[model samples]
Structure formats: C-alpha cells, structure tokens
Target chain A: MIKITEKPIDVQKVIDTASSLNAGAVNVFIGTVRSKAHGKNVVWLEYESYESMTVAEIRKIIDEASHRWPLLGWAVSHRIGTLKPGEVSVVVAVSSPHRKESFEACQYIIDEVKTKAQIWKKKYLKTGRNGFQQAHK
Target chain B: MKLKIKTFGITRDILGGRLVEIEISQPTVSLLRSELTRRYPDLENLNSLFVAVNNKYADESEELSSTDEIALIPPVSGG
Candidate 1:
C-alpha cells in the first residue's frame, strides 16, 4: 500500500500488510516530528505535498527497490497537514525472506522518499514564526 | 501561451499565493523560469528549484503547452 493522507498514519497497518508467511524478517521505519530544529524549539509541524505527484514518486521508488531486492511485500504512507511533536509523519515497512534484504530495502525506501518525494514541511517555532525549510538537507 | 503554475512551501510565500498565471511568448521550461525569476526575484535565493510538467520532473529544455500542469518544486524535505 502507498498513500498520502491528512490523518495520522497507522504504522501497524503498514507492518501487517508487509507481513507474510514467506517472509522471515519485517523492517519498519517510522519518522516523527522533532521537538527541536536547529536548536530552536518547535511548536508543531505542517506538511504539504503535490498529492498526485507524491504518490506517483513513492510508487516508482518501491518498484525500483523491489527490483533490487528479493522482497515479499512493502508499504509506504505519509501524513499531511498539522502534526505535533512526537507524532508520526511517515512509515515504511518491508518484508523479506532474509533479514539483510529487508533492512537494506527499508533504508533505501525512506532515503529515496526523503529526496525524491514532492512533500514539504513547515516548522512552527515557539518564537511565533513559521519556518519553512527543506528536510534532510 | 498562458500557464498556471502551482507553488508550495516558501515558493507559495514568495509568489504570494498557491497558484499564479503567467503569459509567455515562448513555451519552454527554461523560459518560464526566467519569466518567474524576473517577476519574483526572491525565487533566486532558493538553493534549488525544479519544474514539474504533467506530474513528472521536467527538463528546462522541454517544451510546454497551455494545458499542461506545471508546478514549482522547491528542494523537497520529506521522510
């Protein structure tokens, strides 16, 4: 499953979808909003995306990763709109017959999603200003 | 040709809105960028800016049409 949504992501759903009898290992990566950015206190975070393009790009990344790994299943989901600190922002789950392949594929998916996906984040600072900066820069 | 461009993040603030319509004589990605930077000079301050046409990242050399969907993609910050 691949989706961009306004609601909080269900991490368990992602893991369940990627779980299968053929898989011995299931790797999950969860991204959360940091309480501080650049040493400044963060009040909250707002996420936005070109929805159609974001979903399309994620699908492409999954396809590429699947080609390079012997995967059983995988799921990627992102949350948009307002999110407070400690909230989950994104989740990536991958299952494979071997532990190494699942771990590698899960890492690759999140890294690619960070760079290639069209999602953007805005940081609401406790200083009463909103800072919009690219993530993973 | 007339083009509708979608903006996000700081680009929306720089453009002063989520969408902007611009009229151009030449229909190419590079020409559009030049026109945009000419009007909104602050856009040049960004570390990187990308143009997407019809939901795909487009090259500056690619030709554009009036009906195409164009979006200004600033450096992405997603995970």
Candidate 2:
C-alpha cells in the first residue's frame, strides 16, 4: 500500500498491511515532525507534495527495494498539510522472510523517499519567520 | 509555446504565486529554467531546483509540449 494523505497516518494500518504469515520478520519506520531545526525553535510544519509525482516516486522506491531484498509485503504512507511537532509524517513497513532483509529494506525505503519524492516541508519558526528546506541534507 | 509552471516550497515564495505562465520559443526543461531564472533572479539563490515534466523528474534535454504538466521542484524535504 502506498498513500499520501492529509489525515493523521494510521500507523497500525500500515503495519497490518505489511504483516504476513509467510514472513518471519517485519520492520517499520516512522518519521515525525520535530520541534527544533538547525538550532531554531519550530512551531509547526507544513508538508506539501506534487501529489501524483510524489506517489509515483514512492512507488518506484518500493519497487527498487523489493528487487534488492527478499520481501513478502510492504506499505508506505506520507502525511501532508500542517502538522505540529511530534506528529507522524511518514511510515514505512516491510515484511521479509528474515529480519536482516526487512531492516535493510525498511531503511532503504525511507532514505529513497527523503531524497527522491516530490514532497516538501515548510518550517514555521517561533521567530516569526517560516521557510522550506531540503530534508536529509 | 506558452507553458504553465507550478511552483512549490521556496520557489512559490520566490515566484510570488503558485503558478505562472511563460512564453518560450523552445519547449525544453533547460529553456524553461533559463526563462524562469531570467524572470526571477532570486531563483538562482536556491541550492537546487528540478523541473518535472508531466509528473516525472525531467532532464534538461527533455522536450515539453504546451499541454504537458510542468512544475518547479526545489530541494525536497519529505520524510
């Protein structure tokens, strides 16, 4: 499953979708909005995406990871719109026959999503200024 | 050809709007970048900028048609 939503991410749903009886291990990664950025206090974050492209890019990342690892199932979801600190922004779940592959694939998915997805985040600072910056830089 | 470009993130602030239309003699990603930077000098200050042609990250050599969906993608910050 792959989704981009404005609603709070249903973390359990992703895990459920990725869990399979055939898989011996499942790994999940959750990314959240933080209250500080580059030493500045952040009030909130606003996420936006080139909706269609973002989804396509995420699907591509998943496909690439699946080819690199032995996977049984996977699910990824990203949230958009204004979110407060500590709010979930993204979730990636991967199930594999072994724990090693699941962990590696899960990390690979998030890394690819951060760099390749057509999604952006705007930081609202407490100093009365707000700006957008590239993630994972 | 006239092309409508969608802007996001800092590009939106620099362009002062979400969308802008420009007339270009040639329809290509590189020409569009030249036209955009020519119009908005501040855009050059961005660390990086990418152009998407019809929802896919496009290369400079990619040719664009008038009806194609074009967007300016600044450095992404998605998690």
Candidate 3:
C-alpha cells in the first residue's frame, strides 16, 4: 500500500497492511516532527506535496527495494498539511521471510522517500519566523 | 508560447503565487529556467532546482508544450 494524505498517518494500519502470512518478520519506521530544530523551538510545521508525484515516486522506491530484497509486503504512508510538534508525518513498514531483509528494506524505503518524494516542509518557530530545511543534511 | 508553471514550497514564495505564466521564445526546459531566472533573480540563488514536466523530473533537453504541466521542485524535506 502507498498513501499520501492531509490526515495524520495511521502507523498501525500501515503495519497491518505490510504483514504477510508468509513472512516471519515485519519492521516499521515512524517519522515525527521535533520540538526543536537548529536551536529554535518549533511551534508547528506545514507540509506540502505534489500529491500525485509523491505517490508515484514512493511507489517507485518500493518497487526498487522489493527487487533488491526478498519481500512479502510493504506499505508507505505520508502525511501532509499542518502538523504540530511530535506529530507523525510518515510511516514505512515492510515484511519479509527473514529479519535481515525486513530491516534493510524498511530503512531503504524511508531514506529514499525523504529525498525522492515531491514533498516539502516549513518549520514555524516560536520567534515568529519560519525555516525551510531538508529532512537530512 | 505562453506556459503556466506550477510553483511549490520556496518557489511559490519566490514567485508570489502557485502558478506563473511566461512567454518563451524557445520551448525547452533549460530555456524556461533561463527565462525564469532572468525575470526572478531569487530563483537563480536556490541551491538546487528541478524542472518537472508532466509530474516527472524533466531534463534540460526535454521539449515543452504549452499544455504540459510543469512545476518547480526545490530541495525536498520530507521523510
């Protein structure tokens, strides 16, 4: 399953979608907004996405991961719009026949999503200023 | 031809709107970038900018049509 929505991510739903009867291992990764960034207190974050492009790019990443690893199922859920601190923004889950593949695939999915998906975020700080930065340096 | 380009994130901030229309003598992605930078110098300073045509990252050599959907993609910050 692949989804992008304005609503908060349902982590449990993503995990359930990734669980397969034939798989012995499942891994889930969650991403949340931090309270502080660059030494500033974060008040909230506004997320934007090229919705159709984001879904397509995430699907491509999952397809690549599945080819590189043995996988039974996978799910990706990403949230958009305004979110407060500690709010969930994204979820990635994968299931495989073994623990190693599940872990590796799950990590790869999230990493790629950060860079490849057509999504952007702006941080509103307590000082009445906003900052735009990448998820990773 | 006049093309309406969709802007997002900082691009929208710089362009001052979600969509901007421009007339270009050449119909290529690179030329579009040149024309935009010529008009909006702030866009030229962005660390990285990508021109997406029809929801895919378009190369400089790609041809553009007036009807194609185009967007400005700055460095993404999603996880």
> Which of the two candidates, 1 or 2, achieves a greater DockQ against the reference?
1
Worst 10 residues of 1 chain A by lDDT: A128-137
Worst 10 contiguous positions by lDDT, candidate 2 chain A: A128-137
Which residue pairs collide in model 1, if any? A135-B77
The reply for model 3, stretches above 4 Å from the true place, is A128-137
lDDT of 2: 0.90
What class would a CAPRI assessor give candidate 3's docking? medium
DockQ of each: 0.71, 0.69, 0.68
Report the CAPRI category for model 1.
medium
Residue-wise C-alpha lDDT for candidate 2, range A1-137, written one tens digit per residue: 99999999999999999999999999999999888987777778889999998888888898899899989999999999999999999999999999999999999999999988988888876654555443322
Evaluate chain B of model 2: give its TM-score.
0.93
State residue A21's C-alpha deviation in candidate 1, in Å.
0.9
Calculate model 2's interface RMSD in Å.
2.4
What is candidate 1's CA lDDT for residue A103?
93
lDDT of 2 by residue, B1-42 (tens): 999999988898888889888899877899899989999999
Q: DockQ for the candidate 2 complex? A: 0.69
lDDT (0 to 1) per candidate: 0.91, 0.90, 0.89
Q: Which residue pairs in model 2 clash with each other?
A: none
